[model samples]
Target: MGWVNTHTRELFDGYYSLDITYELLLGGYYPTGINANSNYVARDLAALGLILSPQPPTDPLKVVWKTIWSAKVPGKVALNAWRIAANILPTRRNLSLKGYDGDTGCVLCSHDPEDSLHLFINCPYASDIWSKAGLQWSVNGAASMHECLLATLPRLNKEEVNKTLMLRWGIWKNRNSQVWEQKSKHASETFLITLGWYEDVKRSNASPVVRCRQGVKLVKPRAGQFKMNCDGAYIPSTRRGGVGCVSRNSEGEFLAGASRPHALLTSPFHAELLALKEGLRLAMTLQYTEITFESDCALLVQAFQQEDQDLSTMCLLIYKHASGES
Candidate 1:
């Protein structure tokens, strides 16, 4: 209490090679006054792996130093090191990063990316895949492509999030492969491949199928009233799915409603499970306390209680999510 902290650009030791004071003051991690004045050099001294082939490398540091110094490509290590330091970079992109000089419209839809949502979700090709997957997507007046992806994250769970991420990765990879490799496949095919990958992972685990317990804070219902309505639809064409739901007050007054389509395809049982997920998501969104989820698929409802669904595919995804074992 006798002396107060002061802001200065003094360094602690000579380990780290950057100005810690500037980062602490300007970075979002620290927003205080006195704490921002402190300066410290952060360094990792973890041991590195060694190679035993040919001549055993006595020191791992020497090997790493030699690799960095001997690289033919100039600035390669520096650029790659920067990327490693910033781990939050995206692994995929929804649109051609190459800005349109003449072609302002999306190649897939001929729509403007000014809103950014059109580049990824609102395009006709994207919409078709979504429809095949049984989702009805809408943009919330997004101004950038990143915003659209951010908006989608809050609506997805671990399973749904993984599927969404893989779909994006596959789509981006397909686009690049088509341009460079001169091989093109329809969006529908890519989506099917994504679904197959998800199924393969689940089946490899050999887990039983059941509805994973999802806790959602729902709105409380008034006396003698229902609070939510759930609906399920299955598309035989793509074996894709759509789930729609609405929340209502005790008087049956509408509060909010939503519909989502999935890009993966599977049996009717999986579609039914998707419907349940959609209903639960909607219920959570409206904070409904007493949710009355309804579905036309009876087999799916039974699968929710059964230990094993015996679905030809989608069993692992179902079990992984339902059991929360993963």
Candidate 2:
């Protein structure tokens, strides 16, 4: 069943229409993704058995719940996301459905019904808030608030996602205050709490390295520690790149150096990230623990220095080696 014979392909004209090429990194070995560190025959058999078993249908909304749960947001923020997505939020439309006598028109924008989608995404006041926050999203046609946020959540990095969650909850809080207290808050005042959440996430260990025109001079390590300096170089003409690593002791004496050229590099930023991975691998291989890594890539170094849940691709790759995953 896995193989499509030539006759089968010809009989089904719509089969295998795309042209594709692949370079195999492994050969002659079955890739049992759920196998243990030491491969076993039984594990492979079990994996195959599970794959062959009849599986129940999947729920698309479950994926949205997974994303919300995985984000490093506060518990209340996640609850708010769930309530809004499940269509249980006490917006004017929802309350009216529960026999509320209050007006269903949006308190902030009297022109539209205060449903979750309109109150949070499509209303003029909400649009103004989003624009003020430097986001331009108009989801008037979206079926729900969940659909509007889920569309963009995949593109945002971890930091952006956390901030977005906090910001949306803050906006809701502001909306509630305006509804009951009958006093409006300024745009800046409304999101002051959201800004605090962002500041708190970036407050610890977020020391950004200063870039200089002359070049950043390597700082020598303290006693009993080793310093690893790294830099990534790219040649646009050949579309190739290279990285260099140098280890120094407390006296600023070079102990070891390594450099390897890259092939078909996409960008200078990618080159820098690759260089960081190499430096980390080298340090771990050398069994060095008291080490301070220095890199010329400001964004990369700053990301490592930060103490938040950074699920960005760059941060994940750096931690992949540490976790001993191939």
Candidate 3:
């Protein structure tokens, strides 16, 4: 007598899988509690005992109403349950390929089915591009996408993993959009879009750091409060990066100071973002929730306030960490 209840509404109505109910009564998922008169499941089981079994009992709704009367759950808990159900529920399978008129081969590599694995890791174009990006993905020899991800986990840091997941989602979405909407974007275009996904996620934190020496107004902290200033330098040809940060009290006395060098060559904008990110992290560590943020880079400050229109790819991460999830 195995019982199943797919819909939650049915479960609340004192209706349960007969097998599951029996299992619960016999002490399974949770420990058996005292058979109190006010208890829902236990009380119901005591009432039904042998009176309702073998042939499915009618008035299942009556049992449900009795249970609800016995146990009143919080509305917020119910709301959370709904949210969890929506996120974890199994979705409709992809039957779009059966309707595809083009060759069964992949649109990007022209060698395999347009499955999740092929579009993300198995395609030749994707594999080579990932390799060039410094991730040593075994394009030809990998058996499955899961294997590829597992193998690459050690090589991919947190930032890289986030980027990889977003890029994979972007690639899969682009493939579907192109085929279904007839957008007809090139493989490189899809790849670039995938890269852009990282920037989108990080957009909130990418504001450039301003120099304290600049004309930008540095809001001094209130009495007994603290503040910090930070900036970054980037030289494209040298592939060198530098970050500087200084923390001070309301009296303008230095509390902390730090700077570091990075080997990778990057543009001035990237350098500014790096400095801001570092500064924000330091401020967060010091437990300052409402501290002044100033940057010599007008564009970066403006972007932080959403007073500017344009956003660069390099600063997306800085923006995300600073604003959204910080």
Candidate 4:
């Protein structure tokens, strides 16, 4: 048998010897030796085939519907409401439909059949919570949980909608607590808790202002000394670059300024070094004895102060120029 390189796929003309014994190479296949009786059928089925299929393209409305629950609304209460609207919540009615036998009456109030609509929208407890939160329109005429959420989209402003979502979520939590933990909260208490949460969220999102003392001004250099300011700019799309420098006296008067484009593409760090180099060159050519060069790159400044050897090509060049070796 001929052998071929796996990467280059080049066939080798020379014969090669096998390292393994012939008996082992020619041995027949054996069972995995795992206990078949102990194997889970579901786990076996899941591992037997490809895990995922390519997701089909979805439309705008379907996308909107799917993401409605995850919108910028606060609290787990809104999430519960969204689940109810999507009919995914494990309500008694839904569980019954899925072959689970259980009484589908409202857990809070046994008068109406328990569903998303009846539990969230038409329930007297939920209605009282909404009324206390100053949202009477939520329980007025919403036939379904989805209709109730949709009605809030246009009728209420952003803050009101957030409050509505929080209220719905809070009511669901209260119901769950009563059923599962045997703990009940009044409608007023639920509303107050939800309002407190909303207020906390608002305060956290508020932008803070930093105070600074006024009358601070830039300090100019002393007489007979020139200050040189240098900066660089680079365009990523074109891979082109440019460097600029300006010299000013102690009186803040512009002495000279130079702007030049780089023919070769380079990094911002390298470009900054080039600008400083050019500015120093200009100052030397002008016979300036004392000149203070300034740049905004902190890394470049740190490199000048330290003696560590940087092996990068640009950094080496910068080091060479800064040390007057170039």
Q: C-alpha displacement of 92 in model 3, angstroms? A: 34
Off by over 4 Å in 1: 1-116, 205-326
> Between candidates 3 and 4, which one is better according to TM-score?
4
Which candidate number would show the highest lDDT if scored against the true structure? 2
Show the colliding residue pairs in model 4: 77-169
lDDT of 1 by residue, 1-326 (tens): 11111222233234332355345433543324533333532222121011112455475234333433343222432333223223222222322354434434444444553223553466666666667665555557865544554455555545554454455445545644754686756887777766666555556666677887766555556675565566666778876777677767767688788888865656666666765676677776666667666556666566565774343245555665576532
Worst 10 residues of 1 by lDDT: 43-52
Output the lDDT of residue 6, model 3: 27
Q: TM-score: which is higher, 1 or 3?
A: 3
lDDT of 4 at 294: 86
Judged by whole-model lDDT over C-alpha atoms, candidate 1 comes out at 0.52
Report lDDT (Cα) of residue 127, candidate 1.
Answer: 64
Stretches > 4 Å off in candidate 3: 1-219, 307-311, 314-326
Residue-level lDDT tens digits of model 2 in 1-326? 11223333443336323131001112222444533442222224454454446487887678677777887877898888778778898988988889999788887778557898887777666676677667777555778777776676666777676766777787788788888898877766555546555565565447866766785565668999998888899888988999888888899888887888889875676678777767777888888989988877877778777998654445554565457653
Candidate with top TM-score is 2
lDDT of each: 0.52, 0.69, 0.55, 0.67
Off by over 4 Å in 4: 1-71, 75-78, 138-143, 209-326
